[model samples]
Target: MRVLIVDDEPLARARMDALLKECADVDVVGSVGDGEAALAAISEKQPDLLLLDINMPGLDGKALAARLAHRTRPQVVFCTAYEAHAVHAFELGAADYLLKPVRVERLRDALRRVRQRLESQPREPVGWLHARVRGEPIRIALDDVICLVAEEKYVVAHRAGDQLLLDDSLRQLEETYPEHLIRLHRNCLVPANRLVGLKTLADGRVLARLAGTDFSPEVSRRNLPTLRKLLRVG
Candidate 1:
């Protein structure tokens, strides 16, 4: 994967470039001192990924990312020194972030995620699985989902009065659900719009209540914030 490093600090850029070289599949195609130069390089080189610093002299990284959000832009990984900007980086669809003075292992992990994104198939549209129910893919409406149950490797889509088995994993469904689904566990995905309430059980377990259903799905600790954010409670 071709990568472009965008940072004003000479030393930081150099360090990142050196670390990136350790990955056989990653090629440091260009290094620019500012966002303007980064933009120019993007237009010229069209690198596959960008290791960007949030602050710069000319155009800031956030502004640049906003402009490129809709374009055939390179996947972004914010290499900022500030922890405060982490949320902003996520909001911008950044593949990942590396705090300044990056660790080699972390950078390697970021690159691994970038590779996964590049290799994964484009998400099948919402409810596309309904058509494939009987060698004929069923078309389920997004609103029909009441809850999702994960068992082994498959997710079962439970609607208001019926259920359909989907051949997608929870991770893939997370990407597909986006604004519509809330993650209740590492293995389960729930419809965000269908969530009625969240409660902590006597056993010290968190569960999500789905609208129009008695099902209360378990919420893993790691996915709590994601669910809270989707429920507008975070």
Candidate 2:
């Protein structure tokens, strides 16, 4: 399991890192002092687990976990000095809560529970999307995907400055990757992480702007409300 440690205290981060090394099947991907850095690491490193501290100067662990509620990827395990936030921590879908100073055995138990939970869930598809470019087989990393748009009988996966025609249907993609893709329209799906904002045109058409691409796929009226709520925008 890949883990990211988030804590304001340097000693706490060091202790967690030291203890995690003793745990089998665990890898410390990155450790940061604040939630903002943790969020950036999440996007860049994509750690499987987060060992978080609840009380930090800015963007506390609870707030950061709430920000990440849209999708499930890096599971959270709260490691705090206070027990007062235990209920709230579990409400945030934390895999486990460990009171600090976290003991080696308690840390192991928390990881065991996280491992079991992860094992029970459906695994994400292998990072690559098999598709054709120039009638030749090419593999596109799912991380590079900006969005997926249905073009008549096929779905086109958009990257930063490129696209690929895929054999998979939107429904198949949705079912298989419910965490990565958000349905913006009956015919369009945008990567949850890449979605930037929605814009309404003078002609009463709504378009979604993604992070790395200029291809603004039209958002169907039927799905606009749900999409707005998901994006936390009007």
Candidate 3:
């Protein structure tokens, strides 16, 4: 399990880092001193777990967790001195809570729970898709993807500067992430949030445009009604 440690105290973070070496399965990806840094790490590293301290100067653990409500969140384990925050910690969907001066045995148990979750959950529980393109392995976070265009036998994921051809089918991808990607045509699926608006021509032709890009695909007649309903257009 990739673990990130977050705490304002240098000594506490160091102690947790040293003890984590006891578990061969756990790799310490990185440690951050405050919640702001932790958020940045969350975007860059995408760790599977976070050993978080509830109390901090700014953007405390609770606030940080709240900020991550939309994105895929790592399993959180609260490690703090105060016991009063236990209820709030659990309310924030923490996997476990360990008191300060953490014991080796308790840490082991917390890791065990993490292992169980990792086993039961899907590999890309965060909507990330793995694909091989140009003879190189690429990890595509769904957020980075702008759209999926179906080719003859593969689905090409279009991004800002790059594109990825996936071996998987568009049907399965749509079924897996219906909330994020919307089908505009039989061969095209676009990021729901990036879709700016639909434009209709004098001849009753419709095109869907996305933000930050001038590229627009012709909207199919079959999906026009649904797309219009989504955009609140008549």
Candidate 4:
């Protein structure tokens, strides 16, 4: 698995790199000294995993994670010197954590969990639910989601195979699928995993291409960086 280490201290980064080298399955692709560099590296390298520190200069780890949440959100294993951020870390759905001066055994355990989760999770299904739309029960699969367009009163669910009109608004959908989907515009949401490519139009508009579909969703300028990060493209 490709991995990136993000830490402010050089010693800590070297230590983590050494430990990661011990695991034959793990390839340490990049290491950065701050959150900004980490974001840049993540956008370029698209690592499968990230060993992040919670505190740093400029953008803190938590803030960086939040910003990158919509884009190439890698499985995160927080490595910090302090324990106070444990609750916050878990809330952000971090896979694991290791205190400073990380032990080899602990690092191994964390890697094990990362592998297990990646292998066990069903990426194809993308987590679906059977919900009543327009008083008719319909199965909404996440993988089929192309784009979500919002009207004044309700949001429209556009899927590759079918489209459904939903009573909930775009904001509600954003909250419901925080980890799985991301907002490209005020009225549209796209599956993060389905985002394959992005392009800037001559009109200065950004568009996102969905995997397995020709549909391109319009992206607002404010959210462009986040979208790019989520897609693991710089």
Candidate 5:
């Protein structure tokens, strides 16, 4: 497992590193003093687990965990001096919490739990969709995608804050994420969760408006009735 240690104390960091060396499977990719640096290290190394400290000058460990709510980049096992924060740590979904002046045997127990958790949790079967942008390959997560629109030979993937143009087709996306995406039009397939309801125009045409977004995709005549029933809008 790739490991990153975050602690403000030098001796504590060194002690933790020594103990981790006993675990032959773990690799200490990087160690940092603060949560800000830890965030950067996680983004760069993409570690499997983090040995985080609770109390710090800028960003505390709990706050850091909250900031990471969007994506579970790395599993966390907080190594702190305080015992009072145990409930709060587990509430944040920490795999384990170890008290300061950690013993070798206790640390081993935490590592075992982490390994078990990783082994038990099933990973998503479908991986990312690779698209080249600005001469570099950019992989977009299927869950982050909002919609896919067919444009001639290319498909335009609309995401939360960005877009990706793909050489693939809309039919390919439908086949891959059939349960998550619904065909809105002949050329458009939007995420099922994003489709809030159908908006009927004065001319009797309808458009599917997305939740938390301003843009609405046109609802095809064939798909209009099914979408209305799905959204429970008569």
Candidate 6:
């Protein structure tokens, strides 16, 4: 398991690092003194878990966890001196909370739970897709797809300057390649990274604009909040 330690105290960071050296199957990716630095480390290292401190000068641990609520990676475990924030930490879906002056045994227990949680979670499917473009069978790289839309019995995959017909349904695509595609409507699945913006037309219909293509799919009202979260805008 990859871990990132975030705390304001230098001694606490060193102690945690020392204890982690004794633990098995663990890698310390990086250590940061504040939440802002933690965020940067998270983006860079993409650790599997975080050993976070609750109180700090800016962007405290709990607030940092809240900021990462929309994301699915890098689970959090609170390591704090105060016991008062236990309930709130758990409420934020923390894997575990350890008190200051942490023991090696307790740290190992937290790591065990995190490993179990990670193992039980379903992994997203990757690789290529076999589809047809103008009756020509070609394997499309999943990363090159901008969007997939369900039309009658076929699903159409849109790339930069091409469109291919697929046999799989939108729901199947959404479930199979969750890391690649996000649902904008019942009929539309757009790659999270490919999605760039949302445009409101004169008819008051919101459409999702994707990168590498001009095809804008209609966004449903039921999925508006999800779209906003994906775009990180309201």
Per-residue C-alpha lDDT of model 2 across residues 109-151, encoded as one tens digit per residue: 9999988877777546336777897888887777667788888
What does the lDDT read for residue 223 in candidate 3?
Answer: 95
Superposed model 5: Cα runs more than 4 Å off: 69-73, 122-130, 133-234
Best by lDDT: 2
Candidate 5 lDDT trough over 10 residues, lowest sum:
121-130
Show the colliding residue pairs in model 4: 71-229, 71-230, 72-229, 72-230
> Model 2: residues >4 Å from true position, as ranges?
70-72, 125-131, 137-190, 194-234
Clashing pairs in 2: none
lDDT tens digits by residue: candidate 4, 1-234: 889999999998998999888886998889998876775566456677899998898667887666545433477889998999999887777889889889999999999988887776523454664446668877776655667788777677776566787756777777777888788888888776556567789988889876556678788988898977764532
lDDT head-to-head 1 vs 3, winner: 3
What digit string (tens of lDDT, one per residue) describes model 3 on residues 94-136?
7889998999899999989877876776556347866887778
List the global CA lDDT of all models.
0.74, 0.82, 0.80, 0.76, 0.77, 0.81
Winner of 3 and 4 under lDDT: 3
lDDT of 6: 0.81
> Which portions of model 1 miss their true places by more than 4 Å?
121-234
Better of 2 and 4 by TM-score: 2
Q: What does the lDDT read for residue 51 in candidate 3?
A: 95
Residue 8 C-alpha lDDT in model 2: 94
The candidate, 2 or 6, that scores higher on lDDT is 2
- Model 4: weakest 10-residue lDDT segment is 122-131
Question: Which structure is stronger by TM-score: 3 or 6?
Answer: 3
